[model samples]
Target: MTLPLPRQRRTLGRTGLQVSPIGLGCSGFWGHRRFAEGAAGRVLATALEQGVNLLDTGHNYSGFNAEPRLGRLLAPLLATCPREQLVISSKGGTLTGQAGLGGTEQRDFSPAAITASCEASLRNLRLEYLDIYQLHGIGEHQITDELLGTLQRLRERGLFRHLGINTHSRGTLDWLAANPTVFDVVLLDYNLLQQDRAAHVAQLHEAGMGVLAGTVLAQGHLLPYRPRLPALSDAWYLARAWLKPSSRRLMRSASKMRRAVASIASQAPAQTAFAYVLQHPGIAAGIVGTTRTESLLQILATDPCLLDAADRARLVAVFGDGRGSPSV
Candidate 1:
């Protein structure tokens, strides 16, 4: 099937890289038990064909299944697309074992382990250099001289063009952003519920570092709170959370918020969530993970400009304006 390409492209902060406003986050490409390889490849091919240049993945996602699956799709594309035409980003720091399922993961940021991780990734990806190489999930203490020196050495060897950090911690993100010379990009979880990092994202962008928003869908909490589309991850989470009253309350609150967003935007809750993240002025790209082409197409079809002055105000009122009220 022929798909229309997205016309929008934004600068990835000061990296001088231009990418589609929305990039495919590939953590669940084949890591999620629900995603098959053929479907994952189709979604990827569709995204790339539509001018979405940024592809985000990590070594530990899907228990090490994610990167190799991505590499398989990319290998064929490399035959036609020039290496520089695509912006591939991958992270490391966590090591997985046995199968792609969780349970036996361990953190290893030692210089030797990091070096080995990059070399292994290169072999898996069948590529000479990555566009963006990030430190997976490191705390401030992990930012030692040894780690920084190792990243620099990797860069000098042409292993990657730019350095970035993908952290769940706002303090680490802020610290790295403050030291702009060490990192070129920042990827963090930012959604309505986790707006604590929103201002930091804008701050980093202003400091001339690319900021990519992850978990924009709030781990599917922002997806349409409907019955037919239950998520496997959500089900597993809810099973554990259901036992606790506080977790139940949080789930109920999230459901109400989703419904409210749908009513306010006169759009599907998922579409509204995608629109919300893409409209952020400082966000270079909002990374979305999907296993199906239909889901990807829906996101690609969303017009970031769909939200107007009043819609923006309503969203801010509903979700709070901690991330600023700039329209995209």
Candidate 2:
């Protein structure tokens, strides 16, 4: 499928921020050392040129080096275009000081800690305020008056324009259902191999909150072609598959899709995989993580063909969509 390069932009909730259908996620990118500066520059340049405006990063991404790297690379680019051409976003609360998710992670959602993390991210990114600031993988029990109050204060102080959460907790989802207006956006894993959050995303959208879908290619598990990057290499995903129940479950689904996709369509499953999630009504952008310009180019070229019941069913059946996964 050949999508119009740089697909049309969508507004994030009511924030008045315009974002591309495909955005760059900075997780597993910009580690402190052993990453080539030239390689990252190429990817960032291509993305900005292609009109991908949203960049999602967490405070702990790449051992706390992602934001600083982005700051240096993106500063000149922002000057070339309008400063508002990019929608900068970052997450805090999980101060693991490591690149990829695993057992060594540490999480803190206290008022002072969350506040300090946001401030540090601003300094690292060298920005006045982020367009969106999310709580990195926060659980329901962590949501509280003190934490919410601190975030509210941060927004009022112009540290961040919006507050969002990256989560898969049922309890947090239920809380969002009750207080739909509290947060302005959500970052969640939404893709063909996993569709459990399909209905939840739609509900969030209907309530007027923006959605940024991550891991749209199942952590490169479903991509026909994947680039090599330290800390996010094949070994990393393999480790993820072993440690995470969801990853293990999706591995089974990816296997089925790999065998079936070639027979059904001319496009690679990676293309179809992205389209499957982009067509979901609520998503402001599909936040794809990549350090290679070629892979980013492939994502920029996705057309998101409208899917009928059978086409949808064929894809969804691989993972068995629960509660009728989001479809075109």
Candidate 3:
């Protein structure tokens, strides 16, 4: 049986679309080998039945297999729940043709490529129009007039309801902050371990743009259980101290911060991370890429309003004490 929808809904910027605080990142559907056939569909179904409204996917995920997999499952789900009840989002502009190790090929953000990417994504997703279409990992150098014009044309054609950019580059954030009138949403990486872009979330909100946070758990770094050790702890810690002092400090601080957050809320480390990102008033939603239905349920069960003022202050002291984050 399908579950009831959650109570909390935030407006996706000025689009007037009320989205759940937690969005399902569908990349794991076909992007990873560990996810077996029908597993992703099951998770997707659970997420929907439990009231997740936003589903985010990329065009080039799993060599373009992600959208097709999601489409196959979405077809039946849409029959039960109307398409308008869900916010379907997809991204483009990542060249999958030359996507191997140690290659000279880079992402193509040109107008022709962007248009073709969107058209192909629509076909793969088996959808009439995407709720939100984003430029995948767009950087400052890629924000050209041609690219903007192409996106505008796509919107004019009813290909997508809104346009957004998924980026963590400082230059791209600066450019977006300067030219805020172009897009409706911005997806970026913001977690307790990396708060550099935290300030930008407010900036985008002030400019009337939705801010969707990615890497909320630092890509699983904040997961509670991990391998204990294999005698490399001393060497690894020593190397970190010498090569990445800031990262070392952040790691040490994270351990203590997790305990503190758990003391306040009694949640897993990963859930605490989600609460941190979702607590930000400017944040519209926190995108979580889970491979299991249980994982999605854990996220769905989290209270977005868990973090109090003291919790926020302690978290800020951990990663915001004038220390630079290590490059990912």
Candidate 4:
């Protein structure tokens, strides 16, 4: 039997912003290929029309073009949807305009760089202030008193309402857990194949900071094997996928999960993957960033997807935190 999904919103930490269970990630990194304006705009329109109000983007997404693109598309939507109703969160700290296709992003969380990036993002999005502004992919060391002071000054200046951070590091989460006052939101990488940080997610929640799971789809790697791309997209995604060693181990064990999962009859693997993430405790929403509208539709189709205790335990036995078999 098909279960109905919830249409409610969850509190985004102490910021008091209510967001949908599915947030649209505007990274524009689909295979590192060019995303046409028409298609991108269509994705944005369809998402909003379908009740998705959270748009997650960053300063360097799509080589520094995602923000402006979103700006142009959002202008028309604002005519109907109140700006406050849509929670637009963006990240900076990653250096923009760097050469190369899907190469490493140089992070610049320095006060000067962050200040400039936030200001430029405000200008690009054509907004007075962002709902949430994050420091993209920085370590705990970067989260110093000076950085706090810098963000405080910017927040005081009305650049943004809440502070956020985007990271895949558990250590970073631990640091934030020790000092949850540092940020109001966290964009984390958690998916069926990468579940090691589940506990830390709860910690952030306990500390009153919202957690948005990024890469919930694992860059589409969690799906069964598919044919190679004709271009560099596959190469880029594969290379970056190795960055998460645990995921690498999980990929080795993926064939086991590729088999039929119990209780979920005839459902798509994409939906199952999404369900596992959203159902995880303390996860506000799962962020999906695909250029294809169909992919987003599939994810939304499973809004508040269900995975009972048996399903959860079975997933752990299979994925095992994406780490190899338990140590002896």
**Per-model CA lDDT versus the true structure:** 0.74, 0.76, 0.77, 0.76
| Residues forming the 10-long window of minimal summed lDDT in candidate 4 | 319-328
Q: What is the Å distance of residue 157 in model 3 from its true position?
A: 1.2
By summed lDDT, the worst window of 10 consecutive residues in model 3 runs over 97-106
Residue-level lDDT tens digits of model 1 in 56-151:
888777667778888888887787667777788998888753222322246789999999998888877788988999998788778999898998
Q: What lDDT does candidate 3 reach at residue 116? A: 93
| Candidate 4: tens digits of C-alpha lDDT, residues 1-328 | 1112248787888888889888898875541326567877878767876788888988787778888888888877676656787889998898854324444467878899999999999999989899999988789887878888999999999999999998877778888999898789999887766666778888898889998988776666667665754545455456656754544655665566656343355356778878888786688888888766887788788834466667667877776644432210
Per-model TM-score, in order, reads: 0.86, 0.88, 0.85, 0.87
Candidate 2 Cα outliers beyond 4 Å, as residue runs: 1-5, 29-32, 99-104, 224-232, 240-246, 306-309, 321-328
lDDT of 4: 0.76
Once model 3 is optimally superposed onto the true structure by TM-score, how far is the C-alpha of residue 18 displaced, in angstroms?
A: 1.2
Give me the candidate number with maximum lDDT.
3
Off by over 4 Å in 4: 1-6, 30-33, 96-103, 226-253, 260-266, 303-305, 321-328
- The best candidate by TM-score is 2
Regions more than 4 Å wrong, model 1? 1-5, 32-34, 97-105, 229-253, 321-328
Residue range 1-328, candidate 3, lDDT tens digits: 3435688789999787889999988884334434565777788878887888889998887557778888888887666767788899999888863234332235889899999999998998889999999998777887888878888889999999999999867788888899888889999888877776777899999899999999787655455544546333234323434444333445654665555555666466667788888888899999998666776788788875666677778877766564435333
Candidate 2, residues 248-322, lDDT tens digits: the string is: 556655666655554457456667778889888888889887766877887788877744457877877766644
Compare candidates 1 and 3 on lDDT and give the better one: 3
